[model samples]
Target: MNYPEFLSYDIALAACAALAVLITLLLLKAFALRHLQRLADSGRLHILRYAEQVVSSTRLPFFTGVALLAGVSQIKLSPMQDRWINYAWVVILVSQIALWGSRIISVAIGNAVARQRTADPATATHLLLAGLAGRILLWSTAALVMLDNLGFNITTLMASLGIGGIAVALAVQNILGDVFSSVSIALDKPFVIGDFIIVDNYMGTVEHVGLKTTRLRSLSGEQIVFSNAELLKCRIRNYRRMQERRVVFEFGIAYETPQQEVERLPQTLMEIVSADYLQTRFDRAHFKGYGESGLMFEVVYHVLDADYNVYMDIQQEINLALLTVLRERNVSFAYPRRMVHVTHLAEPQESAGQAGKLAA
Candidate 1:
């Protein structure tokens, strides 16, 4: 065949191939979606089921289209040009396949690990960390593969990347520290989502754990982001870990109260704390000392939970109960007072009377 006939034949062949691929992709999509529907109807499908189906069905046609277009482009190019074009297209297609395949495999593995971790609470956090690490590794590998396919010397490229990454690490040493700290936090399970934490007076619940920063939803409904490095360095009080919270309170009794009543104060406060459901375990009470205006007594007890609201409620109830008991027992709180003497006036009157008698 002459050059023009050869060109025509190639064009026709490429068109036929493109049409066949398009039609095949459409049929495959339909078959896969139908299979997904059947699985969904069987009640065996989970969160990952639909996700896998969508990714597979979408990528199949998308990649088929890319390949077809690349093939058609190759047909119109010179031999040398076609070689480069084919290389680029193959790289693109391979990268896409790697990405999609990695995603599917990751999803399946993550789901399986999650299911197993659910049974073992201790492993849940580890599984979550593993899942995230897998995703990062997958994408990183995909990127390297694409670069390698583009005629780049992978060994040299990797060495250069390592050097550059080291520079970046040095430049953002603090940030990198925080990111690693966040990973440690996740793995250690120091605090999880919805746990209340106190860090340097910033009290809030952990809302999210991200790559570099952690988000906290404050009691006032404000979102706060803290660097994980700084957070890990600071003293973190996780209230959720407290089995029981200790409540300590002080009250004053009037000095005028009888000695016997004052001695009975400690026992009375203990009884009050022990009688309430809010008190987990009562420790002890003491007549601490005399205050500026009153006699002070200290009461201590533990609450069942570390929740702020629950603690406050228990404290309030105990206070009210204490007041009621004190009033019934005729124990009155103290108030400041002053006493004045009139001795000078009395002496002057007596002297004046003596002077009058002498004159008479």
Candidate 2:
């Protein structure tokens, strides 16, 4: 067997060619990314974002393998060498495909989530979970494909995995429940981030939504975390949705005030409430009825703004104006009082003399 002294020079030449090709591919990738980034920066082809993502995740292994094939034509190889090269490339091709496919799923889901983020931030969390699930599925399926291409029977493997997956799910059932509850919370819009809510007895602004729990920033400046399932179960009072605040206040006037003045009390209250014309709407001002010590007047108004500070400001102004006007009208604020009659009491001096006689 004249073993052909196949010179090592041919192998060296092939190695050099493969190295050159890999370097060229890398430079091309860098240049392509830079160009794509420019296109993205131009702010015109918004579609370039997805393209950039593809190029970004894009690996050169596939091209590297292809470049290695170029050297194959240059060499006189044994059947064993050729077969080994073929198998190696086949594995590379599968990996590259899986890489690209997974990236595409991620990019698409990211874009979808971004669009939904602007339209509705609540949906973004749920969409993020969906994106994660999709990526997992894609990569797992890709792994199966890779194994199958390597001459393994995936039918039995998939069947076995199905049972294993079920067992794993059961083991983490509580965690999974919370995860799904977060999705449900996002979809249902129970309360979005930044909303001030009172759930059961806990009151706070929602800060973040997580797979297991939702976090809140309480008025006391502490962060409160609630399990998504428990949060959903609790009754939520969303004060963030309030448009206006209805306020009712009552005051008393001296019973000695004239009947005419008492009749005029309702008009005075209307004037007082309307003093801050822009912030409040006078609902009703009534001389409600006689009280134990005085005449009671009830005033009802609606603050036009949802801000607590604004409500307080308007109420304070009304109170100041009412006090001034009531004084001008000689209307005195009433206080509780009682009168006791000394109809049958002995004089103090006579009582003292009687005490002295008893002592003697």
Tell me, by lDDT, which candidate is best: 2
Instruction: Quantify all predictions' global Cα lDDT against the true fold.
Output: 0.77, 0.82
lDDT tens readout by residue for model 2, 1-360 = 233545667777888887888788888888989999998999989878777877788666577787787677468879988777777777777677777777877788777776876577666766666776777787787788778776778999889989998999999998889988888887788877667899888999887787898999999999999999888888999887789999999999998999999888899788878774658988999988899889998999999888889999898988888898889989899899887887888999999999999999
Hey, what RMSD does candidate 2 come out at? 5.9
lDDT of 1 by residue, 49-120 (tens): 745455564655465756477458737777887767767676767666666666676666566656755365
Best by TM-score: 1
Candidate 2, pairs of clashing residues: none
Tell me, what's the RMSD of every candidate?
5.5, 5.9
**Where does the lowest 10-residue lDDT sum fall in candidate 1?**
117-126
